[model samples]
Target: MRITRMLGAAALLFGLTVTPAVADASPSPSASGDDSAPTSAGTSFRTATEVDQGQRATASASTGDYLYWSFPADAGQRPTVRATVKLPATHAAQTWQVDVYDGLRRRQSCQYGAQTRTAEQGSATVELACVLRTVRAWSEPWANDPLPGTYYIRLTALNLTTADLGQPVNASVRVGSKDIGGSAAVDGSLAKPLVPGIAVSSQSDSEDGDTSKAAVLSSIEPDGGWTSGWWSDRWVWTGIGAVLAALAGIGGYALTRGSGRPSRVPPGA
Candidate 1:
């Protein structure tokens, strides 16, 4: 009889412990993925392959126009470039080529193929095209340790005779970094010595703690499919919830201080 009684007590204790554990383990519906979906379309910029052309050049016959591509230009310094050149409606040409250089310092070339019609407007028309002669033009991958300086791009128009066209050279190239899809190297000035506006907060429970900021700015999703957010593995909210629950349990204990204690004076004595 006593053993049965003990078994019932043990079963009751086990039930109490197991109930909360099971409840905690049950999955709950939640808004989990991509909490910060961009409300508007993202800004279009050049990728490593796409270069940027900022402004048009004044008319010139002596030499072709030059375009400038800036590094560290945007928040993330994406390494791609784009440029547009509008040819005079009267001008006719059969072949064209583009030359990309390291701003009169190191000469590099990328042949973006031939000019194709992109758009047409009143008195003026735009052709979407690139200057690539051979399969591998001279465009090079952006350097992580790029020296702070100016780079140049030269566009040339070829006539039907496969030679220089008398028409003036006027075009633009938009310059930017390619979509590395990985972390760019950090420089000392922009890298170290944490500043409020600069550093991205690290995962709370990360081994490095809050002290670790991302080495480089994150322009896109992380490389390994990892993500950052409130519900992400090391979120502070889970710790916050546990803290609040502990406080509540403490308060409940304090409230029950006298519930089980016998009074000094006998009841109904």
Candidate 2:
């Protein structure tokens, strides 16, 4: 009876310790393990890769330069993501590494042990490599999925040869934000008068006693389109027209007064 009691207590203690550990390790299914792919902004993205070669290290020393790939210009629904990194012709037979990062500069995924081979023998000749364009290192994220923002993708060639080769390339993509892509030219309206976001107005008295009007417009967001302001469209038109008409009258008087008339007559004998 004593031996039986001791064995039972040991078994119960073991079960209690192991069960908690298993519970901690296994996350809730609904929380992170649905195996569903992440959503994105579906913006078109393109960025170059960096290439290099080294003498000491088998792979070349290359750093991918991050470039702005694309983004959403307006707010909209989230999209699914599809990204890729391409190796150029100058790449030699060696292992390479590709890394993906989030907006916070945190490394999300790293994939190494990639090999490349080409059937070429000349410097100018193109070397061909075959691999999956889009690599998925994880089926699901550890915590929440990536939110709408800019993300970076980096690729480095490993085990490179001792020769000057292609440059390293890095690219970025805007994941969810609506303002992540190229912009177009905005057409001006009468009310707006194409006044830029930051406009500096200056009035200076010239040597000839005429006031010169000059303004510099700084860059603005939603630049190439109509923008909202304090005044209504009708009120803005009325204000702009009144100011421009007054300036035009002043300019006209200056031109007429300055025309065919010398500020000072030549000294007479």
Candidate 3:
């Protein structure tokens, strides 16, 4: 009975040490009511308009233009992107779509939402939306799980009549996120968001007004830089320590277990 009690205590201690820590729930993403945000979208990834979560972004462009916007996503968030296109008066039907891509430029599949819509002839607007899977703290190299990073949204006219190609159009995009909190946390988090470094002019521009001379990422970092958050690879070392502790408990129990009463030589001569 004493040995059994010791073993039980060891297991309980191990469980306590390795229990996954969870953070308190934080507020949801901000609302899209900020009117002061810029009202333009980028034509390409390099120039993608960066917006805060749930910020309203609008742009005026031709029917077939590709409008791109980017936003940061933290772990445990499920980001949903909704886009609306105000179409000019036209008799031709058209198809519009909004695609979400990770910072690696890899397209992420939408778990739900109407990602594409075909506007009927004379329709005033077309709306599309996408709900991405929950962001993960960490994932295996072979897995394509969504991780905390900078995500991009690309809106374009997928199918349109040739005559409607250059028709004037207006678009608005909003990205909102739902925080799932610590329920979906894993052993570690990414060291940084997969944000690209924007090109910056060389300091030589100070002497010469010409700003053409450029330096790549060598000098510039993304605004605020990247952070690892609370979770990190150190969890691996913690897990190893827990395992070693459990093993040591078993070894100690084996060395000291049972036969507490000193054994006398059985009927020693």
CA lDDT of each candidate? 0.34, 0.31, 0.75
Best by TM-score: 3
Pitting candidate 2 against candidate 3, the one with the higher lDDT is 3
> 1-269 in candidate 1: lDDT tens per residue?
44355446555655665455444333222322333322111111121111222222222221232233322221112223344555555543333344444322345344343333323222243434333221111123463222222333444443333233444445544333432111322222222111122234444324466444544222322123211111221223344456556655665666677557667878786
Better of 1 and 2 by lDDT: 1
Q: Assess every candidate by TM-score.
A: 0.30, 0.24, 0.66
For candidate 3, the per-residue lDDT at 256 reads 82
Q: Candidates sorted by TM-score, descending order?
A: 3, 1, 2
lDDT of 1: 0.34
Clashes of each: 33, 23, 0
For every candidate in turn, the CA RMSD to the true structure comes to 18.7, 32.1, 6.9
Please write out the lDDT profile of model 2 over residues 1-269, one tens digit for every residue.
44355446555655654454344333112222222222221221233221110000012223232232222111111222222333444645544344444433454432222223332332322222222112111113454333222334343444556652445432222122112111111222123212221122322332333434433232222223332222222343345456556655665666576557687889992
Residue ranges of candidate 3 with Cα displaced over 4 Å:
1-29, 198-269
Give per-residue lDDT, candidate 1, residue 6: 47
